[model samples]
Target: MNRMQLAALATVATLFTACGSSSDTGPQPVAIDFKALVGTQTFSCADTAGYAIGTGTLPWIPKDFRFYVSNVRLVDAAGVEAPVTLDASVWQGYGVALLDFENGTGNCTGGTVETNKSIQGTVAPGSYVGLKFDVGVPTASNHLNVQAANPPLANSAMYWSWTTGYKFMKIDGLINRATPFTFNFHLGSTGCTLATPGDFTTASCTTLNVPSASFAAFNPTTQAVALDLALLFAATNFDTADGGGAPGCMSGATDPECAPIFPKLGLPFGTTPAGSQASFRLVTK
Candidate 1:
């Protein structure tokens, strides 16, 4: 071959190699924003006289209450549930770190408390089908020693020394007209027979199965998950007249209210209502 032809061939080869490298780089990763909408609703007694004591705030009923939710999940269109694990170190950047009573920790008061916090992360571009996660801490991680917790997980007030575990969910406030009218909806593993003096052990305790659920098929790229706080109280039976606070009131013994509340909170074990299911909507922007 002629010298001129050989030189041209080398140049062509170099150009093709550069083009291949550019194609291999691919597109940038897509960012996904996760949000949780939380709130409460007022319910009247069975007689319909006035709103539930704990549900309302007045001179007599000073402790008008609210429930805390954390540890949200994001599901893709393929039905794969991705648990949005919050960084236990930094509570301010994401939102307030509320105590998860389901684990047995009482109400988390310290460290910028966030009711309905929203967070964002990067995920490969794809269609997400739905999202699901626990409204309370799962049985496994709930048994941690609160006294030893640090940073985001360190809150002395929420620790329940008597129970030996954290409160999974605390729906306490006021329930009756009595002074300090209160109905401590402290829900956790009832038959907690597990006992370990040191090193914390769950070898003997019965694991309480908290309920959770998901919503209808929704596209995440264009919609955002909106957790409705109001529906959480309305749909469930909040009738304080009956055993509303009974069976489970501070008992930690697997009460009726415990069963219903978890699922409504978009938990894995609770019932998912049609309207309540819309608690979370997906959006692209």
Candidate 2:
């Protein structure tokens, strides 16, 4: 009555242990948060810089700041890419999220009063040595019909249409003169070709200015990614207007303002700038 019963109970216990171990071996889901900043200051439309970019010396006052990031992933020490799943919402779609730091006050009329301070997503739980992502929508989702696209893309302020595609990063502000003049930087693909305006098909743009980044240290739990506005506008003159009448770069190849910004974003000048990225930092708390 004892020996056979003992053996049966031992076999059942071993099977249960094996099943438990197998179930816990897969990757666990983790949440990662990204915070935006201008230098060390918490980014806000109300912030102002005493001086403008370059020698023209227009008074700088931040009015609006927003951008998009996509294809987010984490890199382990062994150099393996860990895929992340983004939370889908009005501000997020096509594997990307739109970050808006502006609240439509002062000189910023194109933005909303509500602001988005952080971006949250889920990734496999692990110690990540690096973080990688794109600055704009990829070609697969970039040139779609804006009316039919996701909420982030459908917004008229972010999309220009089939000829121009989406605005990758929009940093707008006022450079005070007799009146407050606008200094806008709308980054996106340029020189696109399509059969017609109404066609929903994708166009091949000569410059897909989707700059990205790879950081040495990125842990969502302990670090926050920052975008420094001071460094970004250092290369441009806010007072000077180019042939197009805009104060700052609009991803134009010939725009002098774009030269310094290209390197900052890790993109090659006068090219598509597809595989280039730089301009994300990890801040430890």
lDDT tens readout by residue for model 1, 8-86? 5444323222121211122212222344223332221111232332243431111212223344555664667555445
Model 2, range 80-125, lDDT digits (tens) per residue?
Answer: 8877777677777887788887788766677898776555555554
> Model 2: number of clashes?
0
**Residue 224's lDDT in candidate 2:** 65
Q: What does the lDDT read for residue 242 in candidate 1? A: 40
Pairs in steric clash, model 2: none
Q: In candidate 1, where is summed lDDT lowest over 10 consecutive residues?
A: 16-25
Q: How many clashing pairs per prediction, in order?
A: 44, 0
Model 1: residues with Cα > 4 Å off, grouped in runs: 1-73, 82-88, 92-116, 120-125, 175-180, 195-198, 218-230, 235-248, 254-285
Best candidate according to lDDT: 2
